[model samples]
Target chain A: MKKLINDKERFLSDMLDGLKQRDPHIEIIEDTVVVRKEKKSSGVALVSGGGSGHEPAHAGYVSQGMLDGAVCGEVFTSPTPDKVLAAIKAVDNGDGVLLIIKNYSGDVMNFEMAQEMAEAEGHHVASVVVRDDVAIDNEEQRRGVAGTVVVHKYAGYLAEQGASLDDIVKKVKEMMSTLYSIGMAIHPCLVPTTGEYGFDLAEDEMEIGIGIHGEKGISREKSASVDKIVNRLLDELFKHTDSSRLIVMVNGMGATPESELSIVTKYVMEALDDRGITVSKLLVGDYMTALDMQGFSLTILDEDDEVLEALDADTGSKYFK
Target chain B: MKKLINDKERFLSDMLDGLKQRDPHIEIIEDTVVVRKEKKSSGVALVSGGGSGHEPAHAGYVSQGMLDGAVCGEVFTSPTPDKVLAAIKAVDNGDGVLLIIKNYSGDVMNFEMAQEMAEAEGHHVASVVVRDDVAIDNEEQRRGVAGTVVVHKYAGYLAEQGASLDDIVKKVKEMMSTLYSIGMAIHPCLVPTTGEYGFDLAEDEMEIGIGIHGEKGISREKSASVDKIVNRLLDELFKHTDSSRLIVMVNGMGATPESELSIVTKYVMEALDDRGITVSKLLVGDYMTALDMQGFSLTILDEDDEVLEALDADTGSKYFK
Candidate 1:
């Protein structure tokens, strides 16, 4: 797989043209598939995206407190609805837009066909659909990986501080009923147009709920140790956590190690401080990655403290502050 | 080789106790290594560190514009000069301390014995050392990986605007004569307490330069093509580049993939736009990583335009904004 790409679907548009030629106030939108392009305001507007092998998912998280537009789909595929109706008409703003979707099934039927073509272009749209991954315990075919990095940072930080689209889809399904994310792969993520590899796991094995386009994992076993893989992903994120409004992410299935995500955030913070559970915000790294693919993933949310102070706000990223 | 560690010589002091419990403005001293007690301002006090397997090197880069103190060591081991003289006496003030250090040999004789014991406790110490690893081009052991992340982001933005100690050691040795860095590797980088993994290479092998602790690599081959390893790391970073101030970076040798660092920044931006070069800031993902080691590494850095707008600042890290 000798790559340096010029074509191969312009690897995420030449890595978003080297991120808008290294940030000239970032704005990218050729045929809409996002990373915020401007002309946004009036209210609502928080369109997210998926699949482009999650490089800075939903477009390096759009910006200005998170997402205003993003609809890519060619790394794990699922963005057609005319590129989510050109990212809901380039971040709609006649006051109404909120797409944050992630519950797979072709990203919930292509964000419900771009929310019925942005309600036939009359704007006003709404959709939350996150089904955060609890591996698989019949949350009706549970899937959607890494809770779309916390629904693109709390519905793009409440649609950039002007929340609307029904209060940003009612606080993103009220933080997706206490969000939960689970992952683990240990290795298997190559998909540069079938350079093969999307599932393997052998040197000691591991699988858990794998599926960030590499799918495959209900269990696989053997890989053990990192507190037995964070106590089997905190026993399915504390069996769908509810109160104890926590927010711990120990991600990194993009070939793990920020010193093994601080040793899986010290065993998911000692299994959420042995259940007395307090954790307010703590994302260990490789936010929802799965490309180089080794393994890691745990994502509990159930947060109050306003989605844990907007997931400890302040962000830019070379590895999350 | 499985670890979530409780011991491995207390994995860098339980990762500075989960990085000071995920930031209570980080302050950890215990088994005496150091990392300041956050907001203890007293100006010109920018110390730095080495080794602790470089996770967020120099302790998640200290903070408040950046780095007042940081000394870590064990894992690649180097910290003792009484822990860089307790990080230059926990960030000395009266406008003096600097340190930075990275040209290894036990981090230049333990930051030159913590700058002669902070000039025999009178302070006003100075140091600099970062020999910007151009893959050890002999002339002396030549080490110091990933141009020490641009000398801790330009010596932590010039010791957060105070800049003294011989003008932050003459602009960190003019950023080590316009830095160069190189790296590669593919497999071989374990050492989290001898979990082994140093030089083995094979599944399509690779290796070139490689050092950030899993050391060993001047050149090994057979895994080419990320444009022949970005044309042999831009032919050893344009051999001491003067291609009119380049700045590149690619990085991610901690299990590569920001889509293979955008295919090594698309053949390092078509070999620095076919050598007419003029980068002015580029940086790709996984800066200074080696832990989950798969491979990558480019780092250029020539600089100008006020050090390329502080390497085009604005960072928090979803893998370098």
Candidate 2:
């Protein structure tokens, strides 16, 4: 539990400073508290941001092929509306801006408030609230999890190509229609300050549909067979899906091994094949992580070839392909 | 424990197969079973490889800015010399080749024997064997760990620019003299087969100088404060380093968290700063991870701005920059 931070309070600032040093193309605005890099097209800009624990997500994706700006909140917490609005405005070209947000209540509300404020400032803006987690039962209220990655990809891809606000919103709506994700945890990850676990599970057990913030999953069980566990997840998820072509992901929760993830991927691929779903693209590694939680998530998105090609595009991060 | 692999034996092959699918640039030779990209570099082929568990060490570095060829082996086992030599010959461009190696006994013997074989075959090949583990002893016989990253950067930078074998060797000698690394583990990692742990340690205790292959380390003690652990590791590592101007790394052993790694990084920066070292650069995350192992390591390289600039360069893998 010993850590190497200078101070728990300053860790965010110091880390951001270090990140800025490595990529001078990024502009860290203290006034707005947003991270921005120049974009080539003067079009509708895409803004995506949330907690800081998920490295290479909002920030790492802020490159030429992805988001124009990313706003990072304290770990697991949503960025304030002020920061979100600032990021939206910073990257907003005359065309408009699109906010891709997770479906968490706080995150959705904050991004919505930012959208309202941006509209007040005469900026054309729309939002795509991503609720991709398939682990929960009440479809109307299921929590968002790793499926946010799809939003980062589609939203950013659309915005980078000068898609209009309406076009971007339509694209994100299409994306959300096809995306589904479910995750399990073997252990609770700690917030840096508390060093207290965010959640708990027995050493031999796992909880499905666990929230990244360590929210209790819908169900718990002694860790079952890989095929059984993957099937259990697929049973809940695939029954609701409407398509057969998919982009499958077996993501690590920060602490699982890549080798182990590939192992999980084997079962996932087999399960998808058994169900007659054609996996057009695949990613089996830590794309979105939950601090130090020891487990992995299965994200399945039934998408067309365009989305699959975008997902398969070259990336710049340690975990992503 | 519930991995989805077909069989533990074919796990590595499956992973490589997936990697090949995603990266059409890399080619696997059936004749010698060597994996490499078809980047037609007429310069000497820069080849490096080791066990499979320590992902990305050799393969991930095979993009345009990095290595030319990489040979893969089973988990925690060195690739045969024939495979290594085959990779060398396949990529050899008459200018001679540079084999960058970690200091594991298996890796050293295999690569050394390959070097002799390559030289005997009229290839002007030289090598830079890296032994940067500061955990145990900074002697000739000590093992190597995360400092292989440093070697990867310099060796790849030189090799990419078509540096001759002699030039790359001389450069690595100068660079090797200035880098050192030390690591500690909280729990032993589970190997695929037999599900056996690398070593045994009490839950409340930790082992310092942990080898990536789970070799015995230097110190075993009750977990201490992050600052204390950093100081202890620094006392041993800086004993033979000029880390006054350093590229500091706080790397996780697979299962450690960025939350935990950042904590360790704070202590690392403090310990080095207290000793009057000017922090030239910092990389905090999982670079070289032991498969599903719980622990962290600290690597310091006395680097100039040139080295930092090169390190900042992009690689095709997930986690650089």
Best by lDDT: 2
Against the hidden reference, what TM-scores do the models get? 0.33, 0.86
Model 2, residue B185: C-alpha shift (Å): 3.1
Candidate 2 residues B24-90, lDDT tens each? 5677774324345565547656778788777556675676666777778888888899989888888
Please report the candidate that would top DockQ against the real structure: 2
Best by TM-score: 2
Q: For every model in order, what is the number of clashing pairs?
A: 13, 14
lDDT by residue for model 2 (A115-192), tens:
999999999888877788877667667766778877777666666566778977886788788778888776767776
Candidate lDDT scores, in order, read 0.71, 0.73
Candidate 1 falls in which docking quality class?
incorrect
lDDT of 2 at B279: 75
What is the Cα-based lDDT of residue A214 in candidate 2? 70
TM-score between model 2 and native: 0.86
